[model samples]
Target: MARIPTAELSRYLFAGQIGHRGCLRASRIRIAPTSSSLQTRQFASHVESQAPTATTVPPTPLRKQLKEQAKALKASGQKKKKKVDNQTVPGWELTVGIEIHAQLNTARKLFSPAANSFNDDPNSHVALFDVAMPGSQPVFQPETLIPAVRAALALNCEIQRVSRFDRKHYFHWDQPSGYQITQYYEPFAKDGKLELLARDGIAAEDGESITVGIKQVQMEQDTAKTTAQPGEVQWLDFNRVGVPLIEIITLPEIHHPATAAAFVRKVQVMLNAVDACVSGMEAGGLRADVNVSVRRTDDKCGTLGTRTEIKNLSSFKAVEDAIIAERDRQIAVLESGGVVEGETRGWAIGSTETRRLRGKEGEVDYRYMPDPDLGPVVIDLPLVQYLASSSGLAPDAETDQLIEDYGLTAKDAISLMALDDGARVQYFYNVLDALEQKLGSASVDTIAVDRGLSTLAANWCLHELGKLTELSNNLGMTHKGECKVPSADLAALLYHLHRKEITAKVAKELLWAIFRGEISQGGVTEAIEANDLWFHELSEKEYSDLADQVVEGEDKVLGEFLRFAEGKGKAYPQGKLMFLVGKVMRAGPEQRMDPASVERVVRARIDEVYIPGLKSKE
Candidate 1:
């Protein structure tokens, strides 16, 4: 394998003019003939003379022979395989690069004081400077710099003490400023590497490690969003304008599409673990542009082929599809005697194809000069170190501690923390601490925060609370912010369930009602009582009487139960047994009797009446 520059290969791959002849040129091989052919012929003739009257056949051409051999090899399997003549088929390699843009969780925009929020109203968050109005001057927000530095530190990047912003000029409807204020020449952070682990395939040590070299991580302002409608003019929303954006440029080290997707997912997870990004693919909070190129394996990987940039791959599936389609397109072009052109491509998700967007352009020659209106971003080393230390706690470390301290499996801990944002995780930690205090010191020793509280909170929030929020959103009953079911209420519900005051099922119902705003005060118990919802608990005599009545009312089911208890029936029919249980439960106020207990009681009565020799457990 030869080393190839990602840029050169990307250009050719995107150009799409590489021809089949060029590919064949790289696969050409040399061959020589020897006198062994005559000797072999003479020996075959002597052997024929000594045996039967058969003539030896002449040898076939090497290409034809190889083709036949290849066909035979393929025929031994389930499907037909294409013939690859080493002399004519080119061996290709893929090199992948990525540029990731993460939105900073800052309160204000990079150059403006407008709120950095995903507001519904368009252009409401834009300032004069964000729109590049005449006489508008850029004033850097000192607050945005800390999060940027924290993000760099999280990625293990070296932070540059002094970084400057440059104007990247581009013309687009969403770019109302006519130029993007970005870091081009002097970035705040540089030279980091990410180790990516493969999600699938055999665990081969050689292929497991994928090192992504980070060229730079710079802070920039996000462009406004554009909403398009057919036959109507596109609408621009400048709400995202001046929003702090971090652009991370990676060296072209990825070689596979699936690998690229996995890398992106890992990066997303890492960013989300901290509060750097929201990691919402659908909302475009984090976006990626994939740079892909191909080359022959034997040729120097640096003998650059055409490269193409797949812009704004929002989802992991889209990233994988774009890479595959681009690779196939490049191969098809090369096999057809054409050259791949250097260009940018847009992934048409509907068609599952890549279409040419524009010719490739180098880093914009905005003649980048430091803005005269903005001063150099100076980082106080002590402040940076303090912020880094106070950056709460990493989810990974918290998750590990939860696993160790809470007597939970690492897998369970990871699952619990998987989708939680840093704020949510901290909130959960506080909830768990409160739970520990309430339960006393003995409970703390026996119950891990993860297993006792965090795990329950994770399930309740992800399943119950999430379901309620989704339902409320769908019904337009409440905005996400207003659908407030506090963690404390959830903890209270769990505590009630833990104390056996209410069952898990009843607690879920209470939670649903509370989230629906049915509860006005107190907790779930008060809500349940106020709603006149009560769980019926039958005494021993009541249950005995109900069992007797059920036996008398349902002779057929009773017979079946007797047979099942005697081991005479074909099987314990789940459908028939459940039907009987339902009939009995519905017959009286004990309608909510636990299904398992009902089954056990029915089975015990059947054993006592029909199988006197065997115990109920038997």
Candidate 2:
């Protein structure tokens, strides 16, 4: 909350920062549209992901030992959680501040005309300005500010009417400009806070709360990348130089690794929701650095513990793992009567422990000064509102409204917003709006939850469409532009589903078909007519015969029903009934068949055939 002068702030960033980029950025930023910000991974189905593929090295014995220790510490922390988290780890209290660097989603670099692309040939996208060539002067990229403002608003920060930029001097191969330009003093936004609605890696129980302080949101240029392999010369790639990055620095309010990791994931999600970044941490478009320190449980206001900064965690899991490992390591040092040293450490992807990168220095290490090359950034309230309105960002306070309106849980809305995939969220609501136009407002509400429309849409995007895109190796559902399925097509498909013109299966098939280009423009009707992928009503006689054929054909369900009829088997029947019902519908003559009709026929046939036959036998 306290503002340091430009010079002092510059010094502070340099002193506390890791070499090259103030910190080595993490591996990737994965953005998912879900209930909680980055609470769930849209990329991986689950929250836990293995380290990025690039850093999957074999762990040394020491690494294994450290990992085991981390597990032990984490388990102990879980056990100790009763009242205060400060006492959760037992014998030591761990506190953390997370720094997330989200690479802005843009076509051009922050201060260069070069294209900002992932997976292109290395250095091919680099401009002369990127490498800081003598004659190449840095230029402002207007595109960067939109996402930055969106992010600040999402974090509940006050936008500075005018923000200044300063340069922090540091030397590294990746930093071609010996002094890196940053907002060490005046950032675009400051003094904000966000509540991570998670406790222990899942949604906090209903009626629970946790808040992390937002120190500032600084719009800075990402440093160049360096590839170092032991025993070989290090490679410097300026391809990443001058890439626009937003640094979300949090207050040291997180007391546990799970909470810290959740907050980072939340930021990743929010960044995506605001259309600020693509949110793929594995791709290095986003990454996190965690600062960890341990203190005595009784030393509430005592001097802070010696902080060890972990640099470049590739994934959320890695962040948690590194925190746990470092937490235990620091606690052990103190328990053994040794002082915890302040240093910068790097997380080895395959290992359980952190490697000491360098001794942590003070701000004096990087002398801060105003950059003569770049002028101040003037951000007005209108600009902030325009960005927020254009991006369709939901207010951070509207979690409850989102849940009630969409029939989603608080976590679900938070996940959706956190990924900052506002477009997807808007598209989903537009589907609801389309349904409301037909089914009425109340009808739409019933459909979203009771009928599973909300879950269905999320699944179709997460699993089915995700699979299709992944197979094609596209960016998947995260990026609105790159996703193969048009929002209109998805909405139309859902509309057909709501009207009961198509079963869920039929709807999915239609979506895939359309996305695969098997069907061209137009809505559900056109898609259905084009591909013969509709579900229609079956005649009573035809449906009955189909149901009879399925029951007789599948002995498993037939036997189970007979056993169930005799009251020998318990009540829940898993497959036979639905399986028979599905078989009748799919094998029906009508391309567009009514599924409810199939269920009705299947039940009627069971009563006429199975019940009478069983009674006669008795």
Candidate 3:
């Protein structure tokens, strides 16, 4: 048989299955006849006669391939060729860095007795030390150091034994101290890395991992918050003045905005796992400052373009959008043969854009100095180890175990854990253990516990407890330790539902009444009995009576049902069947038969009366 040219083979493959035009024109290439020796000989002779002779010098590897392909196409000149764009946009690359601020889970401020809580009255949580009064001395809280150390360890960083706090001086209405205490010369932790997984897009891998290096994780105090001014002066809230915070600085190693957003989300999950920070992006508990730069493929990391710092990006969406905008801005500048200026910029969340805050020349020095009053923080290694090993396994690990052990999807496990801010996971496990003992099971696993307990906990906590807490907060209700609806009662209510002593609807109503303080322990069962909320057990006679009413009362619905039974209907009688069941139940209001039983009875009666010949179908 005639040898197929390699170029022809590649063209066959490419044209057959590659591009849009290639795929469309693929049917034109016919397989050479291989049946008879005579046919093969003729084909071979024809191919050789058309082939080039040795007098023409052979082409180079790349040139030979191109020439062969061009010759093949020349033979088929009647075919129209599509043009492809090979024009490259020169000097375009994205560089990214991250500045993460994690709110320390501390009881007090880094240098004051001010309570580190959000949503408190303005300035109510502030102390004299927070205001930086002349005589006020800076005293570091031990609780503050623990979480900072924990965060550093979680990031896989080496914690410094002797890290000093410096004065990051800047003039702002919120800063009563005139300077913020932070680590500059010597940071608390260094040399850590994080892995992020992109969620979507063509460039995105469903779980494609990217690792970013952590330059430092330093302990700092948060500045006071400023409320936007409508008329004149911006209202300053000093309550957050001295709140302890950890700043996780990442190297400018990221190349894509999507990857950076993914990294931030993973970090947020990690923080929540360790209970180091609340993942409240809007409330400023976990905030990010994106540092973006651009360069060519050949440019060195730092030599690319000037890095622009996008400040106080609160959400993952904001981080990704701001980085994209910044990347495009830098790319545009570079394409125009202009240099991008190094500056700090503020992201407008509403418009999803960035505006320059200050140029490099206008940068604050933030004079560095150690706090004279506060001494060195000496970390006890044993205590650190104990905290890591015994405090409880990370939530991520538990979530993974739940998925593997229970055959649950990752989304389900994540959803279950995220319910009630992660309290549901713990409560589900606890309740499951109690239930297993009650049921006399020998060591039930996480999967069984998840499947068995997830629904109950979700309803009780997410729906019931959430509603109660929200109502209490809204009404400014105070609990004197004797308020209605204790945790045990909530557990008992779930238990009752599991035992089939109460229906799901009745349980919800009971929970609401209990939460509202309308039902107390003395009237618990009485309230249920008075409301006639118990799950009713239907007798055979009652079931038969309801079935008869459903068959006789609605002639149109009965006709549709008969058609479905006789296999003469194009569509199922679902709506009419439901209406028939409803009519039957409406006739006997005191009969509390569930919709399931009603459907079962109606279907059975329809089959017996209308489809006696269809008995073999079932």
Candidate 4:
């Protein structure tokens, strides 16, 4: 050959190494001379020799070889085995753990007396210690410890009598101090557990509960918020610089995305119950950092693959979707013959995939050292004992109480608690109490079940009143946590509706009238009678006459009745009979008759008239 092109020579060398193992085996490859130069010829001769064959075939190109290898590998065993439990992809098992940073709701910062508040003017709440002034000293506040202990107790954590803070060293624009003050060596609380109930819709298995392990709950100081602008200008908000936080680290026990989301929700409910921290995530009160990883079915149970941390998930939905998207991403990486590096990642708003933020930092990288300024935190024994016994009831306990006391189903109890921080649940009890007092009964079971009041009250409070925006605002804690409709007033409406004195249609309209000042306290009965909203008692003769008028006016409905009476009925014709019943109710003023009574009367009239007409024709 006169001259060989560089591209073609490289292609031959690449394709010559392709082997049955689906990879390039460079040691077994042998090259042939493409140029007559002595240097090239000598190099070619030094390569391993191939045995002679009767017939030779041309080598396949590298691109085609790679595609064939990938396809063959996938078809052979890449997807042959499936995971037994909690499989997001067919052959892969996903693992997830979360780090929740919740800002404590306190009047002052953790170490300093600076006011702990948000959305105020920037720099207004900062103390000299918060800004890391040279001579400023840190003073530990006893008030901050109250909420932290309460939060730990709510999570069923074992509180450490002696815990100390350490300095986590890192250089960032937001941290005015050279280091971050946190608890790394010895945290405040450890070995906590949270149970995800099946009825809450986040259980890993259907109709079963999952218990997630909490590794530690450490107290830390939050860093200042940093906003980066164009041209390298950095803006810092120091309002959040020294806000108190509890870093709740969970063990790698969660597997499914829904379970992770549910776990966070349960934490929020717990914190709220104890008045520990600000539970809302949108206001930067709570944030989640999720660590996600994946492995194949053959791997050992404890042998977890490389994991990536997705940071600053602001909402429960974001926490759920981010884990799902990140887990799928890792599986795809391993399937393509690539290794997933440990890294920190960020999920941009509205984006499904996570982007790399930085390499994962280790403890050595953080250079953790005990803070010289702060001493070991001491907990009072009496206070701890008091909290253990008197901590606010969690949502689970409340759910159980609601079920046993009110005879409400688990679903109904959960729905009531979901409404605005359990305020609706409080209102629900108020209505029941008011009804009990009015009916002169002390037994919840008797009051709720004997008169059908439990289901009736739940329907009005959650289904009807909960749906109206104006009513929800005005009636739901608008007056210092008091219902505007006055639980007693709504109870009166339920009382009348239960006794069949007014139809449900009248009850709803009268409820709105109450909200508009048209109905006042003790005026439910007066208003119903005055407006003719009450159902009037009618004799059998009057009902029959009314039904006859409705049946004669609707010719088409009468025809269907005739068909049914003549034994040519295709179906039960119940709907057609109900239509005529509706006509009879409309014939009365305000349609005050009960629907069941209307249907009964209409059925009798069709039997008396339509059936007789069919007999005459026969």
lDDT of each: 0.64, 0.67, 0.64, 0.75
Q: What is the C-alpha RMSD of each candidate to the true structure, in Å?
A: 21.4, 11.4, 27.0, 19.6
What tens digits encode model 4's per-residue C-alpha lDDT throughout 109-228? 998988887766544566767767658978888889889999999988999999999999996546657688999989989999998888776744524888889999999999877544
In angstroms, the error of model 2 at 274 is: 3.6
Global lDDT for candidate 3?
Answer: 0.64
- Worst window of 10 by summed lDDT in candidate 4: 26-35
RMSD, model 1, all Cα superposed?
A: 21.4
- Candidate 3 lDDT, tens digit per residue, 300-358? 66475778888899777678778776777777787788988888888755332478899
Itemize residue pairs with steric clashes in candidate 3: 406-447
Location of the lowest summed lDDT over 10 successive residues in candidate 1: 27-36
Tens-place lDDT per residue, model 1, 1-618, is 555455433322222112333354332111111123321242233232233222324544434554675576567674422211111224777778999998887889888887887744444455667656557888788888777777777777888888888877776545655678888889989997776643321123327666778889999989877654333333345567788999988888776677777667666656766567744454578899999888777775466677889999877667776877787788789879999998989985523359999888777544566666666776777876886787766655676686677655555555445443323444455445555665664654455644656567556655666576544433121212122565566666777666555666788778776666777544666776676555556766677678768766565656666577667888776777677677667775653566666777766666566345333435
Candidate 3, run of 10 with poorest lDDT: 80-89
Q: Estimate each model's TM-score.
A: 0.68, 0.68, 0.66, 0.71
C-alpha displacement of 156 in model 4, angstroms?
1.6
